[model samples]
Target: MAESLGSNEVTFRLSRCRQSVPRSRAALHAVLGGWGVDQDVLESAELMLSELVTNALRVRVPNDRQVGVRIARLLEDGLLRLEVSDAGSGRPEVRAPGDDETGGRGLLLVEALAHRWGVEKRAGGIGKTVWAELKAPDIVAEPVGREVAAVMVRPGQQVRAWGKWRAVRTVRTESYAAGGLAIVLGLGEGPALRVHAAEPLTVRDDSVPSARERGEGTPG
Candidate 1:
């Protein structure tokens, strides 16, 4: 059984070794398995993650510094975003494979499989993070909090706002108003929310291989 952290998401600071690749991958599979991600999306995520981490580890940087891997559920867009950060500033490029080349196509494979991909400088840090996004299969499972499960915000049902689950002041569902469904709640203080995968509701909150776990495996 994996250790549970109150929050969802994991960030593992990998050592300068190949093992980090698999470690990160396994962590993804474990977390996604618990969240009930689609098998196909999970597989693709594993592959893309491996490539990014592999590239990060392959960079000829100091061994003392560590690489970082983050797996996040982009619920707003229904995307699974995998990011690998390394100290090296070199931007990875997809190269065309030579007829006799045995390797050199990691990014190419990433581009082919990922729904979209990009690289960005680490905010408030050195180096950059190479990220890829994969579309998650529509699985309408409910996104739940520690005690309350997510459901359609019906009238009278309390909701999160400013600082507490304030009484759901009101709900609007006019086709001409805000279009579809919209919730009226104050900003801030509310606990983070989730969206159900298979239903029309709002709520809260992947895999590669087998490897040993090391580094700060903070839950993603």
Candidate 2:
């Protein structure tokens, strides 16, 4: 059973599976609809929820993993926030899309439709939560004229096969970059993926490469 944390937030604690995703997605749609979100925004919100929830379930550890999604509104700014989280160490990456790929296109749609999107470490550093924000169309006193551009990203795969007599063939290709770079790497492989930068990405007295890029640190 799921718990309601008040403040208009609904939490569903369920396993990662094909069946659970649609149900969760539907629930989000209903809840957002009740909030008077327009049809277009409602569809986009549903897509974002579906993609994130699906990712959480797909990449979670196989040992009875529990995934959760939270939807709430910012009372101050009247913005809706959508969060999908899992109790796994895997992070999320964003990248450009490649041709000849199936699936992994959901996140690209989310990034395009959402007003702003980012990832942050879950409370207590046990997991990560990917979130997105959308402006309430009904209540826009002073609209920002700036539009965020969406990137095309998808997922590809490597195929290995044996042909005719006995020769073996292999092909390596991108699986997905939906939403940007949707690949996350943990600290388990040799020469762990790291990005070095000569300058800081921001003026906050820091000198680390941006985290949204591929094969960087954990999301957040």
Candidate 3:
């Protein structure tokens, strides 16, 4: 089961097994993706999350004690935080493994990819939580103010259809005879709509400029 800790945070528990690694990664992707996280930062966060969950599974914890995972987006700091808690003793450290070794490089990769990372003792001292933070890019808000061709509509934007504005969930292109092309917009709550390249569609616009567009750097 998953729980929403806050508007910007989510927490979930996973069984202490290999499958939890991918499950945690997917969960992070969904959360971050929904938050409009940049593609590069999203991928890095997924990798770090996978490593953390895998390490948590390695610890000798009771079978009934599931691993805890928490993901949060720090808006003030523009950072993505990933935490994996296991009910086992000992802190994990970066290791320099020989090239011939099959494993033992998880923390090493985490250190290289993450902006910063460390281990923390869980509340009540039952186990430790491995945490990492990465510099997250500013979310790209959907553009507005002008109607564009149907082919120009991108996923995550809202389009007018069926007497109401619906969120565009996906965009696909289809080719027809004599090199004719059509754009297919899949709505979040209804059937897909097809339109020509020159069809005009309204989308939600960004009323405020983003930090990057304003020449501001990401927060530390």
Candidate 4:
């Protein structure tokens, strides 16, 4: 079961089992999606949450002990915090796994992806909590017509490509005599896609204003 700690916080107690990891991630996705968190940030948060929960499950705890998962959205700071607690002793540490080694890299991934992360002794005095924070931007999907300027496209934004929404990783501009300017977006997956400045592309606008909107000239 999950508990609503406050308007912006929810906590879940999961059994010390492997399935709990995915369950915790689903709960996180539901809560954050309801809050209209940006998709990119939500995805990152989910991955970090999974890693933390997995680490908690690995702790040498009694069978009756359950893993504690807490997710809080700090709107004032535009951050999403994920915490995993368990009634176990040792703290998690990041490690560099060798080429032949297949495991022990979970914390390393968390360290690289999270904006910041740390471990603290649990308030109960018997366990520890590993937590991570990610910069989360509130975003709403808006239908953008084909007339959107090519210069307006930016990385970290999502575009409707190949019949589905894909995150834009890179944006490039090419000028041609016939097309004037074309926007080539390097998506998070698959191949790059090219769209004309006036082509229809659905985009989700982020809370942060784009450079052009902020009076800074379009990025080259």
Clashes of each: 22, 14, 2, 3
Worst 10 residues of 3 by lDDT: 205-214
| Candidate maximizing TM-score | 3
Candidate 2: where is the Cα deviation over 4 Å?
139-220
* Candidate number achieving the greatest lDDT relative to the actual structure: 3
Residue-level lDDT of model 2, residues 110-213, one tens digit each, is 78878999888887657888898887534222111221111111112111112101111221222343422222212212222221222111111111222222
TM-scores for all candidates?
Answer: 0.62, 0.58, 0.67, 0.63
Can you list the residue pairs that collide in candidate 4? 146-198, 146-199, 146-200
Error of 1 at 126 (Å): 0.8
RMSD of each: 15.1, 24.0, 9.1, 12.2
Report residue 136 deviation for candidate 4 (angstroms): 0.9
Tens-digit lDDT track for model 3 on 1-85? 6798856899999997778888887788878766667667888888889888988898887798989999887877878889899
Ranking by TM-score: 3, 4, 1, 2
Model 4 TM-score relative to the real fold: 0.63
Q: Which residue pairs come into collision in candidate 3? A: 143-205, 144-205
User: What's the lDDT for all of these models?
Assistant: 0.66, 0.57, 0.81, 0.79
What would the per-residue lDDT of candidate 1 be over residues 78-165, giving only the tens digit for each residue? 7778888998887889999998998888999999999999999986689999999988744223334333433455444445434233
The regions of model 3 sitting more than 4 angstroms off are: 139-220
In model 2, the worst 10-residue window by lDDT is: 158-167
* lDDT digits (tens) for residues 1-220 of candidate 4: 8898766889989998788988998899888765667667778888889988888888887889998899987877867889988899877789999999978989999999988999999986589999999876453223343435556888987776776566889999888777588889999889998878667666775334423345443346
